[model samples]
Target: MTWTSYGATCSAPSAGYSASTFASAVQLLAAAQCFSEESLPDSSDQNFAAYDFIIVGAGASGCVLANRLSEIEHWNVLLIEAGGDPPVESSIPGYHFSLHNSDFNWRYKTVNDGRTNQGNQDGCIYWPRGKMVGGSTNINAMMYVQGNSEDYQRWFDAGNTEWTVEDVRRCFRKSENYQDQLLDQDPDIRNHYGHDGPLVINTFNSTERVRGNKLISAYDEIGIKKVKDINVANAFGAAIMTVTASNGERNSMSKAYLVPIKDRKNFSIMKNALVTKVLINDLNQAYGVLVEQNGVTVTIHANIEVILSAGALNTPQILMLSGIGPKEHLESKGIQTIVDLPMVGQNLIDHLLFPITVFSDELTENSEADDEFDNLKYFHNRSGPLAQNVVLDTFAFYATNEDAKYPEFEAYVLRKRKNSSGLKKEFVTLFRFTDHVADSIVELNQNHTLHLFLLSLLHPLSSGTITLSSNNPKDPPLINANYFADDNDLELMVSGIQKLLELLDTEYFKSIGGFLGRTRTPNCDELELGSREYWKCQCLDIVSTVFHPVKTCKMGQLESDSVVSSRLKVHGVENLRVVDGSVMPNHISGNTMAPCVMVAERAAELIKEDYNLY
Candidate 1:
């Protein structure tokens, strides 16, 4: 048996003569200046190689880490991504419809779509990961909400001391820049929010379709209470949504973390340079990576460290490819096993969300009218849905009993009004009144599609893994999400689903006509509350993913059934660490984006402290 070698950089990356694969590489890496390929400059120069640190998959944590580490005067950083940059449509506030099926979408389908696939209402579920530069954040809904204190405390209890609420809180504070006055009266909220940071945070301004005030008022009427700003340390009630945007344009982690420093002399980024595997020496220490570029293979050694920030899905994939995962799985792919770590890709978790579709003819009629339009008007004037968060228009975090264990309730309002009916259903006109008045210029032609995105950990007790499909670099790893395997998880979600019906029954649905239209994916006309059987049938039929995938590479101090220590260093491997959602010991209480960003901030500090960066 012989180990073939070919690389435009140093040793093994074949300069294939295959015209077809070369064209594919050429098509992928045409613009090689801003972000060059991890391979080489061209056919002539195939030996120019190496970097101080090679970070793969420019996602949330990867981008931030690249930016922070490369900032050092003498450090050399090489950031490689398998994808391209986002398109113009992804930047449009109203272009969310285009994001799902476009080029930016990785569009990885599930292997077990039949068992737990609410996202793919139609036969198969499509796990749309961003294959572009900024990764998923470029295409995500962009609602920025941090996990609560208890969420991180759970990590602390799980033996991750560095992940305690206070430890993680510092990271959360790094990305915040609050501009809310109500926070002045509330010390708890004020203490949590930071006044200085790279990202911007502000309340949703007033608009015709949706206003922050109107939402706060409505949620308040139901005893949910009004929050000055939910991003603060304590998130109790409804507050304006935080976003990853600046001046209406989405602020992707790539732009916020990397593009600004593109001109830095020591910094180099290779777009379309998919890392095939991390190169480990005889001592089992990671030293570099093998990347396939425009029809060429290349080796780029990391003189200092090899950091894996490929995100939840791809991070574990790369580790497995490098033979640093479960020994048996790699052997099946005909690859030599390095360190056998059982937890490399286990503990996968994600939110399976269900939208309670409803129609609103009277706008604020559910004790509310056809109020969904208020958001468009809000966005139009930079105040309504456009200014405020589409997810936080209204929400709740509640426990069913006096001594409940975890929060089992979370509901967000969405005013689809007239927008959701175009493909098949007939749209109705928007007629309303009150705090939000439709702008005369923005004459109301229709109603809104109001639905609540809810998910209470359907597979909380269940664990999953990420294994290699083949040794091929282009292939995505097998994602066994282990969704809905626990009965306790079902109990919590069912309770929330039942409560949602009650909210609808309270004149909320009747005021707007009482019948929330059905999804085209699968329609359920016979929804009755008297029986759990009927409810489960609809839930299994209609619910989909909220797109928050976490815990692929769990971290803990105990080191049992864990991939990395609480510090995020890979077990038994020196100069190698996994940073990103993959390191999350447990899922956060809310959106995973904010928490992922917080992870980058804290991890950067830890890296600096360990290296004594001043």
Candidate 2:
């Protein structure tokens, strides 16, 4: 497989091609330049470095904080990232599949306990975290969702009074730079989005493909209303999915927030640098961080604070490693406990998505010649299927059991996880599920498939934990996602699958030749297809993560139930705070990226307010 300036000549992706697939190699090198880290300003010093602020993990939140805090001119900020800059492949919206499990991905796996991942041979699950400048945004689906308003209301209800719906919506608007030029054509939709932030949010024109409109029509036929924008309140219906991209390229955090300010002397980025631990004084004030780079260890001091933004999985790991976690767990690992915050790694919650494959009689232009044309189209004008994401245009958020306060499930019409094919095959080999499920997915990859209905549980009752496997900072954390620990999660998931089947059977879907494909598992052979019992077994068998993990470093008023304060400061430690997805007090209604960015925006304000920067 050779990569060209326009695109690459490679074999079919594991998840197959969708309208969002890359077409050609044109401008590939130029696009790659957009995310390159070589041009970032360097501020490394030969001596021990001290700065106004030291932000750990140059992820979604970290990048935003760095950009915002550094704007004060005199305020020196240092951002450290475990991974390097994203590669050129990271620029293409459709190439996200190839980015996973690669050098750019942390590739963290969970330790299963027989309750979940029962379909896999080893009873384990694969969790991929971004290890690059933009962090997970470098490899995510790039969906731009702000989550339901009530989701934030729950945060306020949990003693977090500052993060009300109005406050969060303000932060959301403040953090976004909506580039949907079409919005100006509609006054109602125009009022729903922000226009002056750095990040660009837009959707592929609905007329660009027939599949997305067909899905929307099917949803409408099923009695679901059509929403003008899913990024605002009342996202309880089908709407065109917006993405975090400008033109056809991925608008990662590093690109959106960091690139414009790369030359600022007050701002410095340390890539490929792993922070070992936060340096705390006898008074429990964070002074700096111990970072390892190129076999050399150095202590970088932060005069103001040490902000932890290493994401949901790694933030708690870093805290625990610094002796700021549970007392008993730290003592057992032979690490001296500095601040015994039991809530540090607890309250782990994530959304689980079950991919329901359907067959369509229509053939998509995914052939070799068409791939070249698509690449050429993207290379020439940044348009066509190559310009979009894997998911189609329509997204539906609905409740299965609860009142319409918040969605119990979110359904998206998209292509398969071509990258997950190999992973699914491994699950089959591990006896995670019988051949009919994983193997069938692998076989269907060779077909001319169109769309997939990925029904994800919006609010799960189950929660898990992230613990230390070893004291070594180089070693990955032991993640116990503990999926489906509560039976209600499975029940809601089964109901969601039934709703998807109903959509497939709609006249609108039938007019487009959409047919439900049977997902058989040996464990459910006795139960009939489409039966609740069969789906329950299937949900337990193949249920996987949607990658929106949060609340591990929970925020609350009490120290016993939370890690960070309502202001985002660590409960007991002074001059230390966690400002990432982990600080979310509850599960969000949609993707976690927008919420994470919103957290960074709020964190910046809180930090500025504390220092009287205004």
Candidate 3:
């Protein structure tokens, strides 16, 4: 075919395009086909045939299970996702923020509790969950953090004997394929991670390396010393984050684990299928699922097991719908109760985020044409501003005291270019900030470069709940994220904000004329800026989730206190299991994607042992 026809075949514009534009379009089309479309397996037609395993929600954990369980040639593995395949934007690291509120996102908003997050729109924070095959992995910033080893120790100490620190470490390594060049220079760091695994982990090919290094030095000036690798150092200090991307593209769990085994004869995937309820019999055993797809409802049976990886919110919703939740709540909704697990939707926990904005004159905003050229650069060479998650790839973990081993707070720096026009929309849409709040941020960015220190309270004393809004499976669950319900959480957050404010006085920040930007809020108008009370007020008004929700289906020994056992099997229910972020009994010190992979890795081994597959 001629060059023009070849470009047309790849969906490039045939006319009214510059030569560079045509070439870039063709390159992007080829990359999408090679990296995503061609590697993804075709969705299976809805079938009533019984399978050995039925996995719900093709999310991070679910994708891992699909690959591991399907490794057995005799087992028929069916993985179902509510959304279709990830769009081309998901494969591009720079487009991560664009996935929010899109078709691939569940776009769930927390039920407004008048007590918290009042500054947000409708007094509620938006909770974005992935609906597609890779789930949140496709949409997340792609940081690969394993959290502190002590986080797993807390789980083991909480009667979860199967999740010891050593076991958790091994499982984390098992799923990791450490591809960062730092491994070649440092033996200790090399030994810290797995070299041969499905998930590719490397440092982002960031264009802002110079600024990142300067930021690291600034963090060091404020007592959070720079570390060689955050994972090797157990997240004790600041570092350029290791991420789950390689060669300028996002390596989502679907691409890392599922794509390699797409041709397996025993594996099957059902896309755009929403699982309404688990099919349970009178004997308290799950047999199948009730799925809604393409305006049709059907029952798909599982001969051996039914696994729920539908995430923190949906897993609990599905259990309650299946009559396996609290007796009072189920009966109130006119659903018969089979097993009264009172903690089914209780003890909801998440890392709460509060943004602290600062401004400087050193950074320059990219123009619209510059952004377009960035896209062209990425398409041509896979190296540009689009090659990384921008400033989100640099982070720091710190504790209140210098002697502490684990961090109480985590911070991610996001740079908003000076005079940028999208800052208001990002604040309003991505963060669901109110118009007043969004406008205040945009007004500041109009004059100077905005440096947002997105601070996360790693662990909180306050917890919330996820409950049924109605008996209807189609109805979204009520997410009562009671952030800062406890007074201690607010106090700690104030301290964390003070810690990050120290950056303003650092040499690196001072050299760039950095200064804290006062966020205009009605409640804090009278309070002195930078005061303890001012920070406290901001904590309550600006608090939202870092998108890590867990513990709705907590894992523990008692049926009264938790929903699943250490093996991840649902308590009081046979042939059913929950393997997702919801199974976390407590909050970890960092982002949750990597830990969820570890949970699935260990859960897979336990399943193999139970079934004698090894």
Model 2, runs deviating above 4 Å = 1-38, 45-48, 205-208, 365-368, 416-436, 442-450
Candidate 2's TM-score reads 0.91
Q: Show where candidate 3 strays beyond 4 Å.
A: 1-39, 363-368
Ten residues in sequence with the least summed lDDT for candidate 2 = 10-19
User: Cα lDDT of all candidates, in order?
Assistant: 0.63, 0.78, 0.86
Candidate 1 per-residue lDDT over residues 497-569, each given as its tens digit? 6655554554444555544444332323355533565546555554456678888888976455888887788
Estimate, for each residue in 44-116, the C-alpha lDDT of model 2 and write its tens digit: 5535479999999988999999999999999988999988767666677766765665778798877868766
Q: How many backbone clashes does candidate 3 have?
A: 0
Superposed by TM-score, candidate 2 places the C-alpha of residue 50 at a distance from the truth, in angstroms, of 0.5
Model 1 lDDT, residue 279, Cα: 90
lDDT of 3 by residue, 537-601 (tens): 88888788899999999999999999999999999999999999999999888999999999999
